[model samples]
Target: MAEETVSCPVKIHMTTEIFQEETEKIELVLFGHYYEKGGSAYLKYEEMQEAGKIHTVVKVASGRALVMRSGAVSMRLDLREGSRRPGTYENGYGQFPIEAAADEIVHTRTGSLSGQLSLGYRLYMHGDSVGTYKMKIHYEEVQAAK
Candidate 1:
């Protein structure tokens, strides 16, 4: 696949404890880099929240390491469970409560990390009922254009 450059503004909030007991002070950082299937970048700072503790809201930077702005990003995931028989599409739209769980990862020049994060969303299914789904995403903060 061709290389595509995209800026991702990541905001991480932790409420768990790092390691086994000690609390942590989270430091959010923004970095600018080119992302590819097998590419990586570095963090502006080395200090981060404790290894296993959780943090409230950690502001990583003034805005984006590459730029600064206020915006919103949304990712949609569609899970297709195997049908009972076959040739039958079991897809409907309505009010579905979606429960998504995601984790944060920092792909630095040195290495990559995998953490545990919990996320939730409301999926609209049929009628007033909703579907709760799970989600897992790995990304990092990036710089925004000035």
Candidate 2:
């Protein structure tokens, strides 16, 4: 038997916290599509910010995750526990070197269509430590109306 790709509309709730001089928290609710292929799961969503619209994609595997964003703000983040990944961030102004050192990455599935992902990492920009950050995402499939 071959594994088939499964795709569905999903609703996502995300919370992010940054620990710098002070802790800052941000939350967002987004609607998108969730799909599973091979042995990996992926989430695709769009976010509207003051800058403009940003498209985001997240891929979760065994012990690692990849996040990619494009539009007004663009960046690719590869997070793996106990390792530092180098990437770049670009916006209206310019592009800057960025890196992420992941301390923890936990992904849990409550059901076939519902799960949660949590990440704890340290962010560096321009070779300088920016801050420690925690991000949590919960996603569930949307049911079609009868």
lDDT of 1 by residue, 3-63 (tens): 5333344433233223223433333332223232223221111222233222122112111
lDDT of 2: 0.92
What lDDT tens digits, residue by residue, belong to model 2 across residues 1-146? 54648888999999999999999999999999988887888889999999999999998898898899999999999999999999889999999889999987888988888899898889999788999999999999999889
Q: Ten-residue segment with the worst summed lDDT in candidate 1?
A: 62-71
Q: After superposition, how far is residue 106 of candidate 2 from its true place, in Å?
A: 1.5
* TM-score to true structure, per model: 0.21, 0.94
lDDT scores of the candidates, listed in order: 0.27, 0.92
Best by lDDT: 2
Point out where model 2 deviates above 4 Å.
Answer: 1-4
Rate residue 77 of model 2 by lDDT: 91
